[model samples]
Target: MAEPFWLVRPRHDGGSDYVRFLPSQEAVEVREGSHLPPQMPLLKRRQWLPLKEAEDCRRHLQQEGGFRSSEPLF
Candidate 1:
């Protein structure tokens, strides 16, 4: 399987939004809920986006400091 792009952010309801790309489906998937403890993976709410829109969303989130790079700062 191809690698997927992933992102995550917190919600005002003390939950989280987990975003990932589904390469096979060629779309971005968003999962919203409390990520830990009480999360129901099978029942979590979801949204979908096109690749271009998803990339744009990621860029916007990064600008807001909601996403961080894995690379270490030298």
Candidate 2:
């Protein structure tokens, strides 16, 4: 089996910055804050790839590119 690729989006919830990762480019509801499961592996800022690179990964994985919000939702 292959390791899953995730599209990470940076978000802020009134106080701190948190990231939401959409696994395999799926359009799922993102959970807010720093309450992610401890079992989930996290990538350091230096280990994170660029958006274009992520897009390429999505193509290689044959996953759909989900919608991207340009403007702030707040």
Which candidate ranks first by lDDT, i.e. highest?
A: 1
Residue 16 C-alpha lDDT in model 1: 56
Candidate 1 per-residue C-alpha lDDT over 1-74 given as tens digits, one digit per residue, 9 for 90 to 100: 24555566656766555555444467777543335437553335667877777677768766884754322111
> How does each model score on TM-score?
0.49, 0.24
Off by over 4 Å in 2: 1-47, 63-74
Q: How do the residues 1-74 of candidate 2 rate in per-residue lDDT, one tens digit apiece?
A: 12333333333532222333343333322322322343343334333345556445445434443323223222
Error of 1 at 2 (Å): 5.5
TM-score of 1: 0.49
Which segments of model 1 are wrong by more than 4 Å?
A: 9-17, 37-44, 69-74
